[model samples]
Target: SSAVTKNTKIVLNLESLGSLPADEAGPLARYASTIQAQRHDYNGKVLSIRAEDLKSLAIIYDMSPDELTTRLIEWGVLSPGADVASYFDDE
Candidate 1:
C-alpha cells in the first residue's frame, strides 16, 4: 500500500517581508522572532513555518490559514507558487 505525504510547512522570503509596509510587515516580523529555532536563514530559503506556526501567524492577521497563505503571497512574504508547502491536516 502506498501512503501519501502531506506537506506541513511554508517557506517565506525575509527580504521580501522586510520590503513591505510597516503595518503589514510588523506582524510577520514579530511572529518570525518567536520562531527563532524554526527559522532558516539561508533558510528554507527564508522563514520556514511549521503547521503550528502557520496557525499562529494566521491569528495575528485575523485570518484563517488559507487566507493567510494568500495574504502571505500577496505580501511577497511567500513566493507565488514555489515557496509554499501545500497545507494539509497535521494528523
Candidate 2:
C-alpha cells in the first residue's frame, strides 16, 4: 500500500536505513532497507503489502498497523485516506 511503500521510500532514503552506529540497524531498519531496495528497483512504485507482510513489518518495529499508520502520517510519509493496504491494489 502507499503507506508502506511511501514510508519504505523515506526509510530507504535515509543515509543508513534509519539506523544508528551503535552496532546494528535492527530488524525494523533491515526491513525498511529491503523495502527501499525494492522500491528503487521499481522506480519508487508502491509495493504491494499482504497482511502477512504487514505483520512482519509490525513485528520488526514492535508496533501495530494502526500505530505504524499514525507514525507514517506524523512523518508525512502517508496522507489521510491513503489506504495503504489498498494502494498497490489500485496500481
Candidate 3:
C-alpha cells in the first residue's frame, strides 16, 4: 500500500505532468490512478519490494528509475541532478 501511495505521490509531483501534451498526461494519469486503486485494495498493507524490484518494474514500463529520472530531467520535470528515489522514499 505504501508503494501505491508513494508512487501516486511521485506521479503527482512530476513537473512534466503540467507541461506534457494531453496525449501524454492522459495515459500517465491513468496509470497513476491504476496504481492508486491497487493501493486502496491493499488496505494499508506494506509492499515488500526492494529498490531493485522497483527498477525491474520500471524496466517493464520501458525505463529504469535512473532512466526515468533522466527523462524527467530532459522534460524539465525535475531539476537536472535530482535524486529520483527521494520522490519515492517510502518504498
Candidate 4:
C-alpha cells in the first residue's frame, strides 16, 4: 500500500473580514449573505455574486479586494472578467 500526502491547504483569514465596518451595509454585506446562501445550496455549481457580494466575501475571507476576487473566482463564487477592485472603486 502507498501512503498519500497532503498537497495543499488554503488558509482563510477571518481577520480580513474586519476591514469593513460592521454597520456598513452594501455589496460587501450582500457578499457575506450570498456565501451563506451558497453553502446552503451546495451543488458544485457557480453562482453570480454581485459586487457587494464580492466586497462582503473579501471581508469574510480576510483578503484584499483583489485577493478575494481571485479566490472567489477559483471557488466558483464569481465569473471570470469580473473585477472586484473596480467594483469597490466605483463606490
Which is the better candidate, 1 or 3, if ranked by lDDT?
A: 1
The regions of model 2 sitting more than 4 angstroms off are 1-29, 36-42, 45-48, 84-91
* Tens-digit per-residue lDDT, 1-91, candidate 4: 1112121122222234334455542444455446657678433233433455445556766778778667545644444544445555535
Candidate 3, residues 1-91, lDDT tens digits: the string is: 4444334323233435556776645654455446657667333222222445446546655776767656656666445544556555555
Candidate 1 residues 1-91, lDDT tens each?
A: 2122244357778788767888877988877766765444444447666777777777888987778888888887776764333453333
lDDT of each: 0.68, 0.49, 0.50, 0.48
Error of 2 at 62 (Å): 1.6
Clashing pairs in 3: none
Which portions of model 4 show Cα errors greater than 4 Å? 1-46
Model 3, C-alpha of 75: deviation from truth (Å): 1.8
- If candidate 2 were superposed on the true structure by all CA atoms, what would the RMSD be? 7.6
lDDT winner: 1
Q: How many pairs of residues collide in model 3?
A: 0
Give the Å error, residue 1, model 1: 15
- The alpha-carbon root-mean-square deviation between model 3 and the true structure, to one decimal in Å, is 9.0
lDDT of 2 at 12: 26
Clash numbers, per candidate: 1, 0, 0, 5
Model number with the top TM-score: 1
2 against 3, candidate with superior lDDT: 3
Model 2 poorest ten-residue lDDT run: 8-17
Residue 1 shift from truth in candidate 2, angstroms:
20
